[model samples]
Target: MEIIEWWPKIDPTAKEWLVTHNGEAVAPDVLTKIVAAGGSLTSDAWWIGEEGPDGFYLSDEAIDWIEATANGEKA
Candidate 1:
């Protein structure tokens, strides 16, 4: 599966715009409106990488962060 980052808007109550293939989306709410108005999917390069990382080199802090996020604990 591809890694995609979904960034919520600053207002926290607006629509979400999808940035394909892990692209950064500033002002995602506005971007979502624009994309919908344009009626198309505008995205950057689609990176086809190898399999996802197997946590082989994940540090203790990384593991903790992942676990916390998995449990829906806010930072």
Candidate 2:
């Protein structure tokens, strides 16, 4: 599913973290919330970054989606 579609379902803390740390690697706990909310990590249009020892760095598209969401804009 698209991040937009499942955004509202994600935990509030996760949303806040995404907004505050826009370009940073996503924490594993937050990523869990995303997956639970139906966000896709394997989708080409969704997550598109490397998984390293630190965390998942979101793709540009993913970052844009979060920014738009924070601004109350449609995806």
Instruction: Give the alpha carbon lDDT tens digit for every residue of 1-75 in model 1.
Output: 111132221223322222221123224354354344442233331322122233112223433443454456863
Q: What TM-score goes with each of the models?
A: 0.27, 0.80
Candidate models: Cα lDDT each: 0.31, 0.83
Model 1: CA > 4 A from native: 1-55
RMSD (Å) of each candidate, 1 decimal: 12.4, 1.8
Task: State, as a TM-score between 0 and 1, how close model 2 is to the true structure.
Answer: 0.80
Candidate 2 accuracy as lDDT: 0.83
Total clashing pairs in model 1:
0
Candidate 1, 14: how far from true, in Å?
27
lDDT, residue 34, model 1: 32
